[model samples]
Target: MKEELGRTIQQLRKVQCYTQEQMADAVGVSVAAVSKWENGVSCPDVTMLPVLARYLDTDVNTLLSFHKKLSEAEAASLISELSDIFFDSGFEAAYAFLLEKIREYPGSDMLVLNGAMALSGAMALSSTLVMDGDQKAAERYEEEIERLYKKASESDDPAICSQARFMLASRYMGREDYDGAEALIDMLPDEQAYDKRQMQANLCLARNQLAAAGEIEERKLMLAANSLNMVFVTLIEIAVREGRLEDAQYLAEAADSTARALDMWEYTAQLPWFELYTHRKDRDNCLKTLGSMLASVTDGWNYTSSPLYRHMRKKEGEERFGPRMRESLLSAVEHDERYAFLRDSEEWNRIISAGGGTDRGAGQDET
Candidate 1:
């Protein structure tokens, strides 16, 4: 509290262009006292708060408060920082860190929503605590996480409110609280008409912001394409499970073609075929699909190569893997027994030797 109060005082004084000496004189305190307050070495006496607030053109409440709002970029950055802390220092550290942030920005809807998400995700992974007989500690964390999400769900910002509610519903579902989940889900908008992205684009167009509107639509299109790809994969899995090999094959082909048409990464495009052929134990087709997949890995892929997504800027640190991805893939193939049949094959040897060797029709016997 002292540190937060100190920061508020320093920020307000700077905004008003007041020197420490000036603030000291106006508040009837020494320059050193004002400096100490700003540095968090000490705080103003209770009676001096009103005088300080008056000189700073703010009420005592405002003078003592932490910032209540965070810009979009600031919120994203802080969330990423919290994730790093969670990974590097462990859940307890990250939980405490988020608690401090929530205290510092009690009214920030973004902070509250994202902080809840971070803690909830970490808490899920910390289930070992419950198993280790620390049930009370885990329960406390769950209660706090739920409270934050509920608080965020009441925010005036519709996006934040909806997301918080969605997260709460998901948590309830995870715990088999079907009634709680259903109640929260019922509160959410279920139709396309309530989609904020399209609404934002429409508003932009109405304001004569054509370029902004186009960008929004393009991003939406990209996301929809990705979702469609996932649906195709899911359908293929279901078809295979139903013993409909022909249907599974057809869906796999459709998935592969859809990926190419949408300009998705070539490696991802070939994965459906790879999985289908591996399940069929079609050695030649498996080798062919694996060869194509490995070649794509060696060839470097990005959205810039896609005509559809070129205009969209990729987020920093978004790439899932780096320079060692190829090495890792090769190691996995060598270790996994599923690929044991392909180990001694000439095509496999060549493909492995050449790092997904040049286009080989060597295993193209599959009609």
Candidate 2:
């Protein structure tokens, strides 16, 4: 044990480019004592552990080689911290910080996967996207994201690989590379059992609980539903690119249905997502989609809170949208000129009036 601890100390010191004299000086020990510790002729007394860990940029337990795997909460905190860095420092700084942390914790698949998610979200959500025909900047983020996903896919841990494969599958779908997406999804099992021998070791290491068959399917369902939501958006975009307005509408409807089934109201914002209705002079479906949005959000339907899919939240158990959600969606669509055709329709007036529109709020249904 002493020799193992000495070896770890020596390795960390050299990796940090610290000489025996420099390390000894930093830790209030003699150069001879540092040499003795590295040679396994002696151990650092308990008093020196904190100083050594600080100098080496690690904790005392790790310095003493008494390492423990990061618990679930610790892993979550790390991911959250990385997210905050991106928000505060911009993507370039965050990316550099992430790579540094990955090197600092090389074996943690959780860290790698979470970092990949952060990068991908930053890319998709950034509003200042350069729309050069090729979207070269977007491609860079996507490429890096794919590289990180590949790294996680290669992990021996099923928990990590399952999520990586799902994200990669969604990316493939977004690229319209259907075969690639399907192939990745195929890698996931239809069911996994807590008592299953093959997963016992992996489960024991990461979660320490067996995933029951029901739990396994629930995970797959959530993954598939979420991935499919994005996948349909990709398909809709492709249809729009090809100028197939009807096809885009059909795809949007399919995506909306799937989202409703999963209770992922986030997709509701995109109900009439494509601008094709106004472009093609198709008013009925446009108004219909808008009406559906109104109905979906009316009477406090709780679109984002399906018990089965609550885990899909950006913050678990928190409402993804606020009470102002209905107002925001209605206002955006109502003000868009593309839907001006519906301005005088009785159904449209009633839709507006029901939502406290000054035109006739008194006689309208509160719902």
Highest TM-score against the true fold, candidate: 1
lDDT of each: 0.75, 0.65
lDDT of 2 by residue, 182-229 (tens): 999999767755544335445544664433433544456766777887
Q: Candidate 1 on 1-367: residue-level lDDT in tens?
A: 7877887787566544578998888878899988889889998889988888788766777667835667878777787788778767877888888766655554467987888887776665564667689999989889888888887887778889899999999989978999999999999976665778989999999999877787787788878877887787777778877899889888888887788788877676777777777667777788887776666666666776566665576676455232234545565566567677777888778877777655633222356
* Per-model TM values vs. the true structure: 0.56, 0.46
Give me candidate 1's TM-score against the actual structure: 0.56
Model 2, C-alpha of 211: deviation from truth (Å): 19
| Candidate 2 residue-wise lDDT at 44 | 83
- Model 1 weakest 10-residue run by lDDT: 317-326
lDDT of 2: 0.65
Instruction: Report how far residue 217 has shifted in candidate 1, in Å.
Output: 3.0
Instruction: Report the number of the highest-lDDT candidate.
Output: 1
TM-score of 2: 0.46
- Model 1 residue runs over 4 Å out of place are 1-66, 119-147, 194-214, 237-245, 266-301, 319-367
Which portions of model 2 miss their true places by more than 4 Å? 1-68, 127-140, 173-186, 191-367
